[model samples]
Target: MLIAQITDTHIKLPGKLAYKKVDTAAMLKRCVDELLTLDPQPDLILLTGDLVDLGRPAEYDHLKSILAPIRQRIIAIPGNHDDREAMRGAFHAEGYLPTEGKFLQFVVEDYPLRIVGLDTLIPGEGGGELCAERLEWLDRTLAQKPDVPTLVLMHHPPFITGIGHMDKIGLKGSDGFAAVMERHRHVELILCGHLHRTIHAQVGGRPAMTCPSPAHQVALDIDPEAPSCFTMEPPGFMLHWWNGRRLVTHTAVIGSYDGPHPFFDANGKLID
Candidate 1:
C-alpha cells in the first residue's frame, strides 16, 4: 500500500502569501496536482501538521480547499501552528482526529500496516513535547499490535536536525519517547514534518524522517547560532510504501522541471 505524507503547508487565505514571501497556496495546488499523477496513486494521505499560517478557522477553510484534489483517505495531526478545534471543524469527515479531547491521537486499523498518530502540539510554543498523557497513550496503543509493522506519525521529530535554529524548537520529551519505542520493535518508521526539510535520523533503533514542506523550507544552516529563516527551495512531499513486510519512503519534489525522457531507444537498450 502507498501512503503519501504532506506537511507544513502553512496555507494562508486564498491569495495571501506566507511570511510575505512564498506563495503557499499556489505551492500546495501544485503539490495536489502532483499527487494526483502518481503511478499507482496513494491509498492514503498523512497530513503532518502546520496546515495553515495562522490558527484561524478561515485558514483551515482555505487549507481544506487547497487540499481538495486528492481523493484518497487522509489522516491529519496538529503542528504548533494549527488550532485543534479549527482543524477538527474543517476536517471532521476524515474522523481520525479526536472529538472530545485537546489531543488528536489515533490509530488506523483498517490498513495492512497499522498506523499511529501522536499529537505533539504544545499550544503557543514553537517547540513540541510529548506530554504525560500523550506518552501514556502511545505506550498503550503500541502494546495492542506488537507484531504488526507500524508507522508513527507526528508533527515534531523527536531527534534533532543540524539546522541550529530549528533544533531549538525540537521535540521536548525525546528521552522518554525513545524508551517507549525501544520496547515496541515492530515500529518501523517514525514520520514527522515540523522541520520543513527532508531530514533523516534514527530514533529508538528505527528510521525517523522529517518531510519537506510544500511551501517554504527552513534554511539549511548548521551554524551554531543561526537565525531562523526560510527559503524558496524546491518544495515536496513524502510517500511511504508498505511492501507487505517493510516500509519505504520516497521524497517527491514539486516544481516546474524537465521530463522523464526516454532512457532507452528502440528495443529498451540501456542508455549510454
Candidate 2:
C-alpha cells in the first residue's frame, strides 16, 4: 500500500498570500497535479496540519476545492493554526474526526496499516501539548492493536528541531509521550508536520519524520536566537510505500524539472 503525505499547506482564501508572499493555493494545485501523475495513485493521503492560514471557514471551503482532484482517501489532523470546530465541519464528510471528544483522535483500519491520528493542537496558541487523558487514550489504543502495524500521525512534532523560534512553540509533554511510545512496538512510523521541512528523528526508538509543505518552508535556521521566518525553498511532500513488511518514504518536490532521463540509450546494455 502507498500513502502520500502533505502538510502545512496554510491555504488562505482566494487571492490571498501566506505571509504576504507565497501562493499556497497555487502550490497546492501543483502538488495535486503532481500526485495525479504518479504511476499508481496513492491509496491514501495523510494531511498532517495547518491546512489553512487563519482557520477560517472560507479557507476550508477553498481547501476542499484545492484537494478535490485526488480520488484517494484522505485523513487530516488539526494544528495550532487550525480551529478544531471549523475543521470538523469542513471535513465532516470523512466522518472520522470525533465531535464530542476533547481531542480529534481516531484510528483508521481499512488499509494494510492502522492509521492513528493524535490531535496536539492548543487553540489560539502556537505550541502543542499532549495532556494526560490523551496520553492514556493513546496507550490504551496502541495496546488494543499490538499485532497490527500502525502509523501514528499528528500535527506537532514531539521532538525539538533546534530552530530557535519554532522550538519555543514546539510540542510540550514530549517526554511523557516518549515514555508511552517506548511500550508500543507496533508503531511503524510516527509522522508529523508544522515545521515545513523534511525533518528526521527517532522517538522512543521508532523512526519519526516531518513532511514538507506544498508551498513555502521554514528557514533552516539553526541559530539559537533566530527570529521567526520563512523561505521560498523548494516545496514538496512525502510518499510512504509499504512493501509488505516495512515502509519506505520518498520526498517529492513540486514543479517541472529535468527529464526522466533514460538509463539506457535504446539498448538493454549499460549506458556507460
lDDT of 1 by residue, 206-250 (tens): 789999998888998987688999888899998998999788888
lDDT score, candidate 1, position 177? 91
TM-score, per-candidate, Cα-based = 0.96, 0.97
Candidate 2 matches the true fold with a TM-score of 0.97
- lDDT tens digits, residue span 17-74, model 2: 9878899999999999999999888999999999999999999999999999889888
What 10-residue stretch in candidate 1 is worst by lDDT?
93-102
> Candidate 1: misplaced stretches above 4 Å?
267-269
RMSD values for the candidates in order, in angstroms, are 1.3, 1.1
- Pairs with backbone N, CA or C atoms under 3 Å apart (clashes), candidate 1: none
Error of 2 at 225 (Å): 1.6
* lDDT scores in order: 0.88, 0.93
Worst 10 residues of 2 by lDDT: 262-271
The candidate that wins on lDDT is: 2
Candidate 2 residue 118 Cα shift, in angstroms, is 0.6
